[model samples]
Target: MKVRVIDNACRDFKNIDYTEVSANKICYRWQIFLEK
Candidate 1:
């Protein structure tokens, strides 16, 4: 799974890379997921 830098992350989080994110599964915000 690969993800691009769609938008910069929160200022508190810098130097964070895409691989670090949980890309293996369907990851999304709780609110957004519910809407779908």
Candidate 2:
């Protein structure tokens, strides 16, 4: 799975540590975001 942060601020943050985050974690967060 591929995830891209579309927000400018989030893009900056993603450039930092997001490379280390697992795909499953990203998917889990996406699921939570969609539920909100």
- Per-model TM-score, in order, reads 0.22, 0.42
The lDDT values for all models are 0.32, 0.52
Relative to the true structure, candidate 1 has a C-alpha RMSD (angstroms) of 7.8
lDDT of 2 by residue, 1-36 (tens): 233432433455566666635544665666567556
Give lDDT tens digits, candidate 1, residues 1-36.
112222233211334433435432223442244455
lDDT of 1 at 16: 45
TM-score of 2: 0.42
Clash-forming residue pairs, model 1: none
